[model samples]
Target: MDLDAYVVAHAHEWARLEELVRAGRRTGPESDELVDRYQQVATHLSVIRTAAPDGEVVAYLSSLLNRARMAMLGARVLSWRAAGRFFTHQFPAALYRLRYWWLGCMAANIVVSAVLMWWFVDHPEVEQTLLSKQEVDDLVNNDFESYYSEHAASAFATRVWINNAWVAALCMALGITGVGVVWLLFQNVLNVAVVGSIMTRHDRADLFWGLILPHGLLELTAVFVAGGVGLKLFWSWIEPGGISRGNSLAIAGRTMVTVALGLVAVLFVSGIIEAFVTPSPLPTWARIAIGILAEIAFFAYVFVLGRQAVRAGHTGDISADLLEDRVATQD
Candidate 1:
């Protein structure tokens, strides 16, 4: 069929589409197919305008193009509004699930902790090399037991809590970018490696409880969760299924605010303990128990309590039981 003639014939629909597009309510899936049809027709009209000389085809194509542009703009605006609402409503629930998400983080910490503990137990002299002189001196001579007893009396607790909270929030926020997450993980890995090397040299396997586990458990777990989120996004970029990479990022962005909130809470608590209790005279046995218990608590909440709460609160069919599953399928 002649392109000019076709566009001229569809002038009525084109005019209506223009009005619908301007209305903006005719967006989303309902209008998407219409938009696609309009585009295909417009493309044909453009070709006809270009090829056919001295014909009404140029005017016809112009009219179709204008209408299609309006419709597309309206659809985009409506889609964005809908996305905004979905995120606003879902963010709190996602944040609430961080306790469960921390299960992965806690497990990572345990693995790293065990490796460091084993290495430190086998080698004790590396402690001086791994840690700064100040750290070595404090660990070896500053009398942690005395420090602990006095820590509660000082403003240290409040100071530490605030500091740790910032760190946790920063880590989670950075997780939005793949490069940021890589930098974060590298810094943490190096720091832990150095500390692990030193602790092994000191023949102090229990140092983890005093210097590490108290707040470290929570602090480190938050790091892992942040890393996991970043890593997930990175992998999505690498293998974006059938969708465009930008689309995958949009989905990830949708879920990040909640993840960030959870990280902030975890860090706040870690900071409080690190500033006051960890350095003070708390019994090594007690610290170990607390650390171990906290790890256990996280897993229990994630696998048990989290599921129950989500099920009770969410009556709509969720399609899947796990977060990863839902995300994957949706993407």
Candidate 2:
């Protein structure tokens, strides 16, 4: 394994490969030659690593291989068409597939929040322990309502969007730990329940709903979706079924990315509602109606468009060429 000798021997093939990569366009014969040389140089690189392990030769070969690989794969070009398809097909399909997970999460949180709210309303002592008399009075009378309109609509919307997006991202990013998602969801539901309970006790329940229902419906749904996806990612390893745990996790992780991106748009819409519609002079009924409509529209997108995309074999995964090839396993 004379490194110098080997380099001299395969240097021509490496140069040919580099040339083809840099040429931008090649004839059929040149393309065939490029592939042939790439294979030879890759083999030579492996031998060099095994025998001599010369850093200079290794670095050169690595760079050459990278260029050759790119030439073979072709450059990826982002376009409006691809972006449109992603939102319409990939994101929605991912949401629809995970509908049950998020829906269950939503239902559970609602029940917990409602129970807490009821408990707080029935037991004034508990509420008093959580917040003092003056704090409760301020929240019920002015603080809760004024919080929405305190800032300008645009700034408020941006702030809300960033905050909510960060929460959703955390759910997916920390989902693998299993506990992170649950902890986040619990914290959020607790906050909501505490607030709802205080408002209800003070006879300001209408004001609470009037302000929150408009944006909270969609905002909470998006959060639940993230939590569900995170939990699902955690479950992929726990119950990988027949597939290898690595493969299951890889698939789930990819799908989780899709959900995270989709939630951004969902949260953005909710932010808009919270900033503009919630604090606007519109009637409470109208504001709540708008929120309900947005929620319905989201569900429709998932059930209708998402279902269609999934049925057509879209799994919210990147194209096959982008993914590593996995060995087929029998059930």
Candidate 3:
């Protein structure tokens, strides 16, 4: 049978059997019947698991966990709203969790960019060899700020976001292919080099302020989050430690939801600023200040605020709702 049909046909019986097995129920006729049903369902699920690779299974499982986590988070946040809480308590912990992936992505990107910058600095003529006349003119004339302000708003930005997001998702999905992480790192590094070249050519040494410092603080953060999610699955196969790859992937997959959700938030905010704010007529000082403040807020959310959510002790009512929801879902 198809998966949904198989699940529907035996889900109740399987659940009953699980409950009975957990409660130390013995093999009476009903128990035997439930056992038979459980075996059939288990066999089917096992076949499906075997046919799928670890990444697909982990992705499927992660999706389920993500839904549950989001529901729980939403309900809690809603309750906090009712009680007049500002709901900033969860951001810092989330940021802390994102740190691993961001650092990894950033390190790889930075090294490549630095090397390229050194090469270009050593060979200025190479710029003309590579760049087109228009590009060379812009770089030589230091006109990127105006160019960025204009192009960042064009439909090209949307296309860029979609294309980048698609690449990230595919890289994340392709972790099953064993080379997904490497592929992702290569693309990330290349992008960094290209951007760095432009910044260096224009002598905008404070490139962070104009090119990246504005919305980049968020956009790059999202990219790092995406890379981290991919690394989770990649590491499962490459260096799972003592655990089996499947189990390691499962564990990492659980955390991927949090990272992906946070990435979504980052992308949404970044896209808006990139489209309207980053490209517009803002003073360099103001842009730098905003960028710095935004980064600080981001760190505070992921590291400090997120950790406090579990212990904020708002009320037991929210906890009761959580338990009830879990029980209902399980039932």
Candidate 4:
């Protein structure tokens, strides 16, 4: 194959292809001509690569082919439609699929918290070891309730949002380690249980529930969801099913990312309730009812909207075009 002679023959056609691509606007005739020239140059480049393997001309044709391909395909532009699809379809589907994991986490944490609270109520010495007498008194009589109203509502909400978001983010980020999620949940549950125990011992259990339930319900649920997604990621490698371990991890990782993003919105709502509603002058029943409504709404969002999206074949992974091409394999 005379590579130089081949180039000479097709050089003018390649130049014309470049000219059409660079012209920005194209008539129907020019667009048709561009497609034809692109195909011709692609074939020319293929032959050159097969015959000569490495050369400046092959590189030039390769670059030209890439630009023409992009021109034909058009650039991917971010739009409101893509954003809507993500939240309506992708995000909810991910949450619904991992619902069991997070729900289990929630149930287990509740039981553990209750058990610890019971133990603390039964044994006064355990509370002493955790906090000194003055500290315990302050927490029960003064600090526990006042903590909520100390800061302005807006600043407190922002603080709660950042803190809870960080914890949830850590759960997903450290979920690959398996034990990290468990440890985080354990630490959180223990703190809540201890506080409740102290309040109960002081005969302020009503106060405890009144202050915590308004925000704790949704706030803790968001944390459980994050932990659940993290644990799912960990298990993907342990039991990859029919897929390759790497592929399983990739799928779980993408889903975890989706859950992480979704949780930000979830935690924000909880933060608002915690800062504004929990410490507000509203009746305790009203505050708790609002929290319950928020919790119910979130679960409904998952089981209702999420189920439909999942049924429609969304799996929370990135769109197919965004995924890398992989060779097909048969198990």
Please estimate how well model 4 matches the true structure, expressed as its whole-model Cα lDDT: 0.87
Candidate 1 per-residue lDDT over residues 47-156, each given as its tens digit: 55455534565565466566666556445446777345333333334434443443454466556756765676566665656666887757545444344445553476
Worst 10 residues of 1 by lDDT: 322-331
**lDDT by residue for model 3 (1-331), tens:** 2556645665575566545444433445744554454444444445545543256543543344344334445444556463343334333343454466657776776677679767776777776677887876665465655655556375646755675566656656665564676677677766556556656656666753465677777676667667666766677667889989876776556455445544555666666666776766778778767767777777666556655653564211222222212211110
Error in Å for residue 292 of model 4: 0.1
Q: What is the lDDT of residue 321 in candidate 2?
A: 41
Question: How far does residue 3 in candidate 2 sit from its true spot (Å)?
Answer: 15
Candidate 4 C-alpha lDDT tens digits along 1-331: 7777877888899999999889777777986787777777777776776666567887798788778766654522244677688789999999998889999988999999999889989998988798999999899889999999999999999999999999999998889999999999999999999999899878899999999999999999999999999999999999998999999999999889888888888999999999999999999999999999999999899999999999999988877644422323222
Residue pairs in candidate 2 whose N, alpha carbon or C atoms collide under 3 angstroms: none
Candidate 3 accuracy as TM-score: 0.60
RMSD of each: 10.5, 5.7, 11.0, 6.4
Question: After TM-score superposition, what is the CA distance of residue 140 in candidate 2 from its true location, in Å?
Answer: 1.0
Ranking by TM-score: 2, 4, 3, 1
Sorted on lDDT, best first, the list reads 4, 2, 3, 1
Q: Which portions of model 1 miss their true places by more than 4 Å?
A: 1-135, 143-155, 176-179, 275-282, 309-331
Off by more than 4 A, model 2 = 1-77, 325-331
Winner on TM-score (2 vs 3): 2
Q: How many residue pairs clash in each candidate?
A: 10, 0, 14, 0
Cα error, residue 291 of model 4, in Å, equals 0.2
